[model samples]
Target: GKGGAEAGAIGNISIYDVDFVPLLDAAGQPVDPNPVGHGLTEIDHLTHNVFRGRMKEWSEFYERFFNFREVRYFDIEGKLTGLKSKAMTSPCGKIRIPINESS
Candidate 1:
């Protein structure tokens, strides 16, 4: 799996599936139902770093396979570095992924 030690040795990012289980205390009782607090429900979005000049390719792939649509574009520049990003979201608006490329 991507989260295994072998994968970790090669890169910092690991892609894998997770099943959520209730948190428990020493007494085995479930911990706070809202562990994240502040009324946060679920992960709203995720970001991916893409190879420079491949943003268009990725955007097309997501749009073709996942029915995602490009919603926004961002260009952030700083003293030493800059990046380009495009945000895409699923048809239902529940999933959002922003692909980025650094300059």
Candidate 2:
């Protein structure tokens, strides 16, 4: 992004990929500091293991525990389709959450 003002005017901008590494503990093991932030591990891509439960209940959990506010949603309609969601910053402005409906 060479042009400061020009780049801002144009909506197209490349946001690079993210390789997340969970904070490790002293014992060289996955630290279970708490239920929310624990089981320290790192993966290439985003792999979400959503628990089995109701949709509204899960959404509420995100709101209550994580303080995530549902920003956008999409309804899937194909053979492998379901509900898609994007929850934006509620507690921290830097965080971005995207949760899909459980199959």
Candidate 3:
């Protein structure tokens, strides 16, 4: 992009892929810190590990610590590995954590 293109957010900073792109105004003054596409939206989900047969314990931890509540459950068996998953989200429904036990 001639005016510079943007990549996804790394934390709150928007990444510009080009090597030499200036985020300056006509007088060479600094522009917005968040130059578009610059902030993390509500966290969709976070993936984590749980020992096999321990999904319940981990799920309970979220419920107790963050006051998260279970919103989804999944159990899938693939040819090579089997997995059990539980999705927990904060009371505001913004932060989500999906814990998985795979074998």
Best candidate according to lDDT? 1
lDDT of 1 by residue, 1-103 (tens): 4335343222544433222356789999977865564675778899999989999999999999989999999999989999999999999999999999997
**lDDT, candidates in the order shown:** 0.84, 0.54, 0.80
* CA displacement after TM-score superposition, residue 102 of candidate 1 (Å): 0.3
Ranking by lDDT: 1, 3, 2
- Candidate 1: where are CA atoms >4 Å away? 1-41
Better of 1 and 3 by TM-score: 1
My TM-score estimates for the predictions, one after another, are: 0.61, 0.40, 0.59
Worst 10 residues of 2 by lDDT: 14-23
Error of 3 at 45 (Å): 1.1
**Candidate 2 regions off by >4 Å?**
1-53, 86-88
Better of 2 and 3 by lDDT: 3
lDDT of 1: 0.84
Which pairs of residues have clashing backbones in candidate 1? none
